[model samples]
Target: MKAVVLVRTRIVYAATAFAELVLWQVPKPVVGCTHRFKYRLAYVVDGTCVLRYDNEAGKGDHRHYAGKERAYGFSDPDKLIADFQADIARWNHENRHP
Candidate 1:
């Protein structure tokens, strides 16, 4: 089968912060991933992408935050979304002004 889009949406959190999520089910796993799903979930602030999760071609499941990259344990689509949202909340909370 061909690639099928599962989710493609942009969530606005504030005037300058928003999230873009795109998920697709491909015929096969990406080059390095073990699952058939390919996804990119990102949270942008101002005009910069400050947080992101992706299973890129050569990189298996991974996430980037605070300018650092790390491996991510991806179990399912539901868990992926949940983890991303949780991180977004953490980021916002840690960066909140007094």
Candidate 2:
């Protein structure tokens, strides 16, 4: 997976050919703007996504599985999306016709 920050805003883009999914997550300003922050989570499965903001209580928590390997992270939404796409691309390249 790959991630990049643009203009202080994190953007993640992902695509999975096997699953026929593409995802994009964009960061937004948190309300109240204290130490506590919130991120809008946008995920696309089979090219469609539902977005929900992470509450303070559930700020960063998620799991991803690639084949038999599992990865866990408390990461920003954008980063996660980018990583997902990169992994899918890499997997497709390695396992499928180019």
Candidate 3:
């Protein structure tokens, strides 16, 4: 199997708050995904994880928010980026406690 890193990025929202995004592509089947791509996104505040998205081997795709984990649909890469950013924006609006 061939793997490629598509994106690796981090954005700072504040001195103690930040978000990171990592996207990867695989040409063949691997752990946790039948899709050709996998990604992980996370938002942290004051060293605490508040939001995350990832697709682990045999687990498909999922998201975590406010310490709760939920299944997430894995669509195209653009949608993934949009969703991650939207979640961070929502968190910023709701309870940006840091």
Tens digits of per-residue lDDT for model 2 on 26-91?
244333332223433333334543222233333343333332323235355456556655654554
Q: Which stretches of candidate 3 lie over 4 Å from their true place?
A: none
lDDT digits (tens) for residues 34-83 of candidate 3:
68887889998899889999987787889999778889887788998899
lDDT of all predictions, in order shown? 0.95, 0.38, 0.86
Query: Against the true structure, whose TM-score is highest?
Result: 1
| Ordered list by TM-score, greatest first | 1, 3, 2
lDDT of 1 by residue, 1-98 (tens): 99999999999999999999999999999988889999999999889998999999999999999999999999999999999999999999998911
User: Candidate 3, after superposition: displacement of residue 32 in Å?
Assistant: 4.0
Candidate 2 or 1, higher lDDT: 1
- TM-scores, all candidates, are 0.97, 0.35, 0.89
Mark the regions of model 2 whose C-alpha exceeds 4 Å error after superposition.
1-66
By lDDT rank, best first, the candidates go 1, 3, 2
Better of 1 and 3 by TM-score: 1
**lDDT (C-alpha) at residue 72 in model 3:** 89
